[model samples]
Target: MVGAVHSLGGQEIPLRDPADFLSLVQRGPSYLVREWLFLAYAVFAVGEGVGLYYLTRPARSIALWALVAFSAGILIGIVQDAAVVAFVRQFPSDYAAADAMTRRALEPLARTVVAIIDVQQAVANVLLGVGGALYSVAILRTGVASRWFGLLGVPAAVASVFFGVVTAAAPRLSELQAVAEYAFGLVVLWDLGAAIVMLGFRDDARQDGHANSPRHRGDRPAA
Candidate 1:
């Protein structure tokens, strides 16, 4: 299967036999690394949601709702990643007749797994879209961060919408699924960069200090 995937992409990689799948599970640490990364991002997103909830209070109830939505989105993302990893780990190899038989035996289960992934992906995208819109509005109204951060929301929302459309049309254009996956990865990278910037930078002028920091708000005069 790995060789077939590589051939499709003009690369070469050894295909794991079905019997080797257990060994791959034991030997390969890449899956663990990927899971760690997904968990790390999920934690970061939760932190951001918490921060946003605190920062956007006293004026708009929307921010609080956004925080909840974003947290849910992050949770969904984590689940989706885990599900994908699980699916990969369980995929039967096409190298041997035994593997083919195993795959046939698991076909029903595989379909169920795919269905769950599809549903989770749809939920994640919708939540992300809602969260992005809410965060953009929060930034605009409160001026709690650079408006440039809000620009990130545009692509994020578009990607969410595109993902839904592409996924729905996946059956019609199976070959284009790879392209959709690539596009989604690009958008995720963009979002991760934006999140890092938002969390790291301290643009005092753009921040709603009074709203974000209670102690500082009472101590300093509003600009």
Candidate 2:
């Protein structure tokens, strides 16, 4: 739960420094709260993907792919979150009581865990970007939401994937990783916008021969 730029007092803790990471892990309750929130987000994202697939059913294949991508990302994220939570709960106290030599031995293991988490999170971000892009295309093709709304997601998705790749390729770019964190906000905003459009403008889809916006066009009865 510690950020890319977490500072203890005036000292900024470098990312994945075992000593600092172990120190922060002692704040187990805080870490648990953050991880639980992440879990909640993962659940919400999956539900949202299902709803989007339903709404954009005219683009059935695209929507289905989008849903798959999102769900896959969420699955990886859940595993990553669970790993950190388990590590925090089980290891910090032991690290605290361990002798210097024991701590040295544990540092490599701790760093490996952090590396794994970084890669998992990066892959998750890339998958989320792919999902967002696909879903945006579905929205555009189906006329289920404003074109501008769909357009907004394209660049955001690109930025997300770009930074995600950078993070995975070079985990040392903490600044870019921080930017990557903000990049997700754009995806979140798109989700909020899409929800509002779905709720408030459900009837709008009917204007452009999109009466089947929420249903597959092929399902319509012949006149």
User: Which number leads on TM-score?
Assistant: 2
Q: Write the per-residue lDDT of candidate 2 for residues 62-176, one digit (tens) a residue.
A: 9999989977877887787677667666667777888889988887787777778768877987897898899889988988778998898797678768766866886467556
lDDT of residue 60 for candidate 1: 73
Per-model CA lDDT versus the true structure: 0.59, 0.71
Query: Could you tell me the C-alpha RMSD of candidate 1 in Å?
Result: 7.1
The TM-score between candidate 1 and the true structure equals 0.64
- Clash count (model 1, backbone only): 0
Candidate 2 stretches greater than 4 Å from native: 1-15, 198-223
**Candidate 1: worst-modelled 10 consecutive residues by lDDT:** 6-15
Clashes of 2: 0
The TM-score values for the models, in the order shown, are 0.64, 0.77
Alpha carbon lDDT of residue 114, candidate 1? 66
The best candidate by lDDT is: 2
